[model samples]
Target: MTTIARVETFLVAPRWLFVRVETDDGIVGWGEATCEGRSETVRTAVEQLSELLIGRDALRIEDHWQVLTKASFYRGGPILASAVSGLDQALWDIAGKRYGAPVHQLLGGPVRDRIRVYGWVGGDEPDEVRDQIAGRVEAGLTAVKMNASGRMSPLASVAELDAVVRRVAAAREVLGEHRDVAVDFHGRFTLANARRVAPLLEPYRPLFLEEPVVPENSHLIGELVRATTTPVSTGERLYSRQEFLPVLQAGIAVAQPDLAHAGGITEVRKIAALAEVYDVQLAPHCPLGPIALAACLQVGFATPNYLIQEQSIGIHYNLGAEVLDYCVDQQPLSFVDGYVQRLTAPGLGIEIDEQAVRAADKRGHAWRSPTFRHPDGAYAEW
Candidate 1:
């Protein structure tokens, strides 16, 4: 019997926390537990949770999840969920490696041969929107997602509203009808602002309007959905199925749970199942590293309600380090005609370069999400 021997966490560059689990039989599995700006907090949580798994059965993934999430009375938040997510992924990886199959195969086999993916274009304060969209088009990508606006006002001025439309219009013009473009509000708009902007974007026909308002204002999401012809998508900040239920019930067309933040493979699969019941499609939100992306793809392959994937191959946030930097073979992550073919390798299906990871951890970073404020010094969503 293979019992768990060690659990470790690494703080990788450009804001990612990776968890490594090794069994007594020497089988190893990797998972990403990144919470973006809160990597250090999540790292500590990972260490605390590791105490529960050190001498347990490696194959008891579900039982471990129950303890890691429920053992503590104070439960369910980004930090704890992120920690469990990473460990959960590593355990599933170990299970797949032990069974000599991919994680998706263990999740009840593949429902699709390949999954379509989208790339990020434009930064927080978007400029050169057309050029970036053109680059993605030239790269043979079929879909692209860009910010709708940056540092928007509570009640947007005419100029602010016009700028949002212009960015989406440029993207639609470049993408044409053959390709798709998704506009992410990045939780930067007020409900009123989102309501006003959503109608203006209808002529351009965006694939979806993401996070039109912050997760806290989710109750208003149904109103926004009712006001717009465009599909409404959200859930990057939401960490569990309970948080997602109201948004799903509120009429979100897509559910964008981050695999690293949403309780890893174990919880996210349940979230996907829950979303399926509401007729909403699953598009796991992933803007971190290879391990997280690999985990997201594993779930995507087996999820029947899967829509498209959001990848950070060239996203603006990746500074000094990129997704493929720690990967031993980049082929599993490489995009071909806008879709990644089903991963056939064992475990999470990609080999992480341990040496590279170790070296990066030595020069660990403190990446904080940029703070934004209004002209009068009031706090603004980043």
Candidate 2:
């Protein structure tokens, strides 16, 4: 049996943390557990997790997860959970490669054949949104998600509300009647604003309304769900099942747990099971690199109630970098009719271009969500 030898992390460009766990037999595995705006903090946490991994048995992933998580009394937040998530992914990669099987196969095989996916359109603007939606449709995507509004006041003006409505209206027109459109509020709206905006976007019939209210005030989610015909979706900001219980019970139409932030495969699998019990759909939130997306696809393939995937390929964040840039074999992620076919390759089913990853690591950039401000000096959400 090969024991774990070294655990190394790379702070690569576009704000990603790639971890590679190498074993005594020279077998190597890769994992990406990036917490968007806080890559450095996650990197430090992964380093701490390495202490528990070095020289330990590589196959005992579940045991290591328990120790790295519960053994430390205080646990299960973004930093700690994300750190554990990355390590869990690496272990799964190692195990799957050793056995020459995909991660989904280890998880009782795939429950479904193909996984449906979605992409982002509008950013902070109400204008140009229709054009963006049309562009996504042209790129072979059947569904698209757009930011509803950005940094509105606690009680936004009627005109501001109207602008939000108009953007949704335009997207609906571009998508016609059959295609899907989901609106993401991005936790930018206050409860009062969300209540108003939710009803307004109803006519467009969004596939879901994401984070209409801030995640902490998820109790308000039930109200938002009741107010709009659109499905209420949130959970990307949430880290664990406990954080998601109330929202799930509130009868959300979709549960969007980001695999990278929600404690990786182990924790996200738990989250998906919880969502299943509540009869809510699972759509793993993924706006990171290819590894995170591949991990999401593996989980989505095994999950029964998966709704649709949110991928970052050609997204605004990718800017200079594309999703296929890091993968050695990008065919598995190729979407036909906005769905990625089953992942048949071993581990996460996508190869990491070590040279590209390493070279990009040398030019790692400090990525920050652009600071926003209202007309007044008050800070705005990005």
Candidate 3:
């Protein structure tokens, strides 16, 4: 029996919160639970959740997850779900380590030899979009994703519409007919404006259009799904399985659950299974740090319906620390021709550089998405 000896949490660089679980036999497993704009809060939440885990049998991940999620009177939010998510990932890592197998093996088995991935290219201009796609291609990425529209309102200007179309067009031209380019709406546009802009980018044949409208407007998701030939992908904002039911029922072709926010391995795996039944493709959203990426990879390896993964290796927000900065073995995440070979190592596969994590922890971040104001002084989504 593997008794949990200690549960430790680290708030580390760029923007990530990691939870490490130590077993009595000295085997350790890692999980990532950082929310993009709230790493500190989630780190604090993991500390509080640690009380429920320490000294328990490390192999009983599902049992611990039940208590962590249900035993507490309060439940279901980014902070708590993310806390559980990280712990669950670490526990799975521990299980795989204990059994001398990869985490994917425990989930069932590998569905593909490798997983395809997409990189981010920020900014709203055609030139920036062009340069970003070229960088990703140069880096050997087969797919790239960028923000579709910027700071839009109820009615966007002709220039804003043109800017969005031009950016998509530029990426398509550079990518030519071989690679795929995904456009993320980022829930930044009003429904009416989103409807107007959707068709404009459609001609360029985006790989997919993500979150054209907010998740709350998911009923309208079906509307957009029916409106375009491009696949509609969403779910990072969705917190639980119930939240995903409607979106899946909305007939969304792609499901984008963020491993950090969507209840870790325990919940996201269940979510992936649920999506599988709907005949929808799974593409876990991960723009945080390495632990999150490792967690995403573990699930991606076992998920049969997985599509391309979104990673933040060279994303714009990674101004301070890059993905491989905290890992001992960065080669597992290394890509060739746009695909990451299956992560077959025990637990989460890659090893964390503890010393590096501790040193970067000292500079801990206090990050908040930039504030944007609408033309009318109202708050705008950032």
Q: Model 3 TM-score?
A: 0.97
Q: Which stretches of candidate 1 lie over 4 Å from their true place?
A: 123-127
Measured by lDDT, the strongest candidate is: 1
Q: How many residue pairs clash in model 1?
A: 0
What is the TM-score (0 to 1) of candidate 1?
A: 0.98
Per residue, candidate 3 scores C-alpha lDDT tens digits across 116-222 of 99898986788888888898999999999999877887689998888888889999999999999888989888778777888887788888889988877887888
Q: Give the poorly placed runs of model 3, Cα more than 4 Å off.
A: none
Which 10-residue window of candidate 3 scores lowest in summed lDDT? 7-16
Q: Rate the local accuracy (lDDT) of all candidates.
A: 0.92, 0.87, 0.87
- RMSD to true structure for each model, in Å: 1.1, 1.3, 1.2
Give me the overall lDDT of model 1.
0.92
